[model samples]
Target: MSFIRKRRSLVLTSTLALSILFLSLIAVMVGLLYKEQKNAAFHGFTEIGAKLSAQAQVSSNLIASVAGAYENKQNPQAELVSSLQLQLNAMIDDDNLTNAYYMSTKQFEIDGQPNLITMIQSSLSSEGSNDNGTDYPLDDVFLDGYHRVMTGETLLTHAYSDDIGTWISYLAPIKDDQGNIVAMFGLDYDYDQVKRELSALLWGVIGIGMLAAAVAIGILFFIIRATVRPLGMLAVAAQEAAQGNLTISMPVTSSDEIGRAAASFNDMIHSLRQLTSSIKQTSDEVTVSSLNLKEFANQSSQATQEITIAIQTVASSAEAQFSSSQETQRAMTEMAIGIQRITESSAIVSDLALHTSERASEGEQALRDTVHQMNSIQTGVLHATDTMQELQLASGKVDDILTLITEVAGQTNLLALNASIEAARAGEHGKGFAVVAQEIRKLAERSRESSDEIRTILQAIKEKTAAASAVLEGSAEEARTGTELVQTTGSSIQSILASIKQVSDLVQDVSAACQQMSAGSEQIAATMVEQEQIAKRSSTNSHHVAAASEEQLASVEEVSGASEQLRVMASKLGEAVSRFVI
Candidate 1:
């Protein structure tokens, strides 16, 4: 990379490192702070737990005092056990308590199976009583303070789980009037709430720590940029120097590392400027010396009349060479023009192809639209077919209804005829009844013919609709095929347009190269004419100054040979330069 690019990249990397380091420091500090806060919170929670345990002891003592007032001969309800249970339940009702239960000691007889009577109040519904005829294990809270309860000291034991592990209970003793252990009371509190609060607090602290880290990173970026600003300025100045603008310089006011770099840049530019000036003067002198040598060589050649006479053929040969060069130049010019024409034609062809592609695209779009419309038409046709099927069913229903009406009409007519016959048996009223029956019979016959004609018309409609649906399906399929063809044509046309665009681009490049060649050949022709004039002038000078043609003639031959060698070298150099196409 260039110096400026490399320097900028280094500065950016340094800034990133500093920012990351600062963020890491912030993380460490925040972590320590959070750890201390978490410890303090846990210590406070432990103290609260101790206080709650102590309070449970006080409530248990009060319950035991109340229970001791009853006589042993009384029933369980009459002995005030219920009241003590109620009081214990009220204490457990506190938000911090989980469960409270009462267990009677005298309720079991065996040593392994300690007598236990479990009592619960309504508020202590989550506490359940298990079989009291079971041995108390070493880990049991009730076993730890068995002596304390026996002594009636109002014992408080640490919290622990029972056999089923439903709740963590703090068990305290209940006593009777004789200062003997009667029962143990307990209060269970949930632990999940405490954990949840701690987790929320941890997340809050982490969120604040992340926010602080982000702020610190932003500040670090600014600080790093301030530190590297002077270096950036020196870097741009150095770039200008490298591009040959040696007068470029950077200001140096500070005594920091960046300031020192700027000072060195100024010193480097000064030295380069001096060196470039010396080199330019030396090159100019060498160019003048080479031209002088060429003139002297022409002069030496002209000193020999024979050589001059032989080279008079050069003017003629040069004319022929010039003519050949002009012809070659003309051919190149024509080729360049032809290539330009071809490029233009290709561009036009590409444009026409693009137009065709666009038209094909439009056709494809139209086909797509037609396909969509055909799909909609097909949907409508299917709906129509459904409607026609429904109509045909309705038509059948109508025919059945007509047949029923005709049957009912016939039945009424038959009933009327029977009534008329009965009337004719009565003789006088029979004539009017007979006429009515005859009219109903004629009307039934006409209705039957009309229903048959309606059925025929419905059958014709069904056939015509079926034929129309088949034609619609065939048309829809043809539309889909046409859409695919149009899309394929559009794709093929687009590919052709792309190929033509590439050809046009290559033709343009060829034309540009040919134009450059024509320009260079014109410059060479002009330079050759200038050299021919200089040769004739040197020949005239040589004729005027010659004191001895023999010595000058020898010099002329030597110079001519040198000039020929120089021309050969120039030709080789031209060939070497021509190897590059552009």
Candidate 2:
């Protein structure tokens, strides 16, 4: 069913059929050879039998005695029969003759009618005794041969079979000294021996035929395999080509039909490969173009989106600008009304500033007196801080005196301990000295205790002195701050007096500046009204631009979709082409 199997089956079937035919031809040839061999064996046996019959005729006397013995139903001379039988046995011993004998025809009466008795043979018995009256079968061929032999003819019998086995007999005539026919000498050639030789030759021919058939079958198997192998390869290549792999080509090994077919198949495959490659390249180009188009569409869409956003921002800014311009126009009208009211208030404020100038001059003189008192207090506080620093130094000197007194007491205690040790060494005589050393030790102890109390009292005085120095430094800093504040107050009062006089002059200038502000506000209002109209037009134009951008974005989206579809189609085409190996 499959291509390769079909091709193989075809080759095998042809080979098998050819083998059968070859075997048949061999069988027929062998049969013919066997027949020819059998015929040759038969002819050779007939010739041999004829030759032996001629040899047997050398003893015509012995053949006559045996024949006469059979005719008279009497035993022949044993010596003469034995000598002839020995000669016949010797002739048969060297060849495939079953018996060498004499045969004769006799006439006898049976049932009062004359019947010719034929095929009467006188042979040596199996025991090598002379037997002269052994009768053979009355075969028609033997009877015919007997008639010929009686007429002084030598005859060779056709092959025939009886109980003694199939044979061809050679019959030769015997004559008296007168040379007339009397009896026949015969040699029986074994037909079975010829058959055995033929059978051996037939077996030899059969062996040779079988060997030839085996060799032919072996050669044919290789030849058929070689013939159909390319066909199988081509079938497989075709199947692959059908599956879109067009890369296979067949090898052409000869100039025969199969080779030519293989060359053609290779050419077809090459053409298919080229076509598939071209298709794949075209598909790739289409895919690339689609991708580029899609990218462009995407860029266009993004640009439109950006443009729409920009326009929307511009429209919003324009709307806000327009609202700000309307508010500015309203603010300008209120500013004009306030400027007129301020012009009337300016004359009244000028008289009040003149009156305040005189009161500020009086306040400046009182602040100067207070600044002088604060400076005096600051000087006194600086002096008290100096005095407290001197007291802290005196307390440090007292602490140093107390340290000297404590050192002197420690020296006295050491001297008293040394004196007490010396007095103890003196024993009863140094008892007074010991009592005096003890009193000195008590005095040194009291002196050390007094010095410790004085150091404590000096430490308390140093603490109080440090506290007093801190309080004086703080009081001095406060006094300096108060002096500076009073001086600043005096300076401020003087500045206020000068400012009151300047305010009187400024009040008059304010009335003139308000008039100028009102005229400028009116001009600004007119300009703002024009700007507001322009902003409103700008907002409307921005809205139009944004709407156009939105429409352009939608168009770009459609183009992007078309590009995407084209890309998809190209990709699918490329994928389809890519399935082929080439």
Candidate 3:
């Protein structure tokens, strides 16, 4: 009953439910069978009563026909009445009837109503003693059967309960020799006796059913227990696992669903064991890694502080370098401008010297043409008076050419001297300028000496030509020498022009180098300015980075503490899982 209200063990509940159901079914079957058997027994008992009624009816007809007892109505026949009573008692005894009796078809008036009278009855009849004539009331069921039997029908009644006992009745017609139904005979059956026998049989069946049900329940209990035992073990293992004992493994005894469940449980336990082991290892690793990370954070913080200080120092140095570079750039720019002016001045002087040399060469060429004309004229005039006049004109032209060359050499020497002084100011940047200036000065000096020699030779030629034709031969020789001297002087002037050009070229190169150096110094100044700004900004940013590193170091310390706690938890988990038996 408690199992019915709440959950119980699987085997126990199942056995009880199945056993009860079987017993109830057997009870229902037995009840139905007993009902049918009791009904049929009642019917058989009624049939036996009918047969006895029929025999009593025949005996009555015999008495009526042979003894003429019933034919003589309203007349007493003692021997025949006794004989009929004795025969009815014999029918009652033979059939084990509650009573047997006969009733006349004739009605007798009693208490202002005509009623059928009991003609005869057995010793068992409770109708006031074995009666020869006694009034009897017929109820509906009895009345119907009585009328039917008087019409020569034999029948039985359904079982009914009276004051004495439960009973069924049989009715038959008694006929005389004239074939008229004179009386009807009835016999009552003991219906309760039939029910008693059936009740006994039903009790026997119920006893057997109870024993069989008990045996079946026992068999079912064993079967269910076998089926559920593994499940019970699985439940115990599950409880252990719930208690943090993951090491337990259920033993699998069968290949059924419960056994497979047990095997799966074992696999789960193994997986959990492996997972917990990994957690422990990982916690240890996390602890070590946290310590390392904390140390790294501290080192990084210190390095950040050092970097901040270093960046401040760099910023100061960069500012100083930037100021120096600016000064250098401005100074170089001024120097470049001065060098450029010097180069211009050198170019102008060289151009003027070159123009002077060209003019001297033109003058020398003009003198040669004039002298050749004179020689041609003189050859003819060697015997004439105008030859000396032509020779004197040629000598004058030669003297003019020599004076122009000397002046050109003087101007070139002055310009070269100026270039040498300017080159000295430019220092190493103008070394080429200095070497070219020295060469120009040497060429100019040599040109001036050549010009003086040419002037002396030309004066001698002029005087000798003035002595007339006697000295004409000597005059021609002197003119030829003067011509050679003029040619040599022209070569010297050309050399001076070339050396001046070289000086101009070298000055240009020095100017360009100075300009390049100026530009380079300016770029260096710009780079230094940018580097100074970057260093200042870097110093500021380094402070921020150092602050962040301090924060990071603090976070790393927290992580180290948390990792230590995690290691402790992992240790506890390992200890918990170690309790189960695998």
What local lDDT does model 1 show for residue 468? 38
Candidate 2 per-residue lDDT over residues 349-379, each given as its tens digit: 4444554555455545555554565456557
TM-score of each: 0.33, 0.41, 0.44
lDDT of 1 at 438: 62
lDDT, residue 362, model 1: 44
lDDT of 1 by residue, 1-582 (tens): 475576567557755664565456546755775576556544433443444334444455554543343224233443355554444444443344555555545444465654444443434554454322233343455555554555654433454556544333444455444555555655555545544655676577567656654664565456545644564565455444434455677798976434544555465445445433433333233233334445544533432343334334434565543443344334334433443443344344334434433443443344344335434534654565566566666756766776576557545544554454444444565767767766765776566556544643543444334433433343344334433433443343344334434433433443343344334334433433443455544333333323233343454444344434433433332332232122
Q: Tell me, by lDDT, which candidate is best.
A: 2
What is the total number of backbone clashes in candidate 1?
A: 6
TM-score of 3: 0.44
Q: Best-fitting candidate, measured by TM-score?
A: 3
Arranged by TM-score, best first: 3, 2, 1
lDDT of 1: 0.46
Better of 2 and 3 by TM-score: 3
Candidate 3, superposed: residue stretches over 4 Å from native: 1-33, 47-68, 74-102, 107-167, 172-181, 239-243, 317-582
Ranking 2 against 3 by lDDT, winner: 2
List the candidate numbers ranked by lDDT, top first. 2, 3, 1
Q: lDDT of each prediction vs. the true structure?
A: 0.46, 0.60, 0.55
**lDDT of candidate 2 vs native?**
0.60
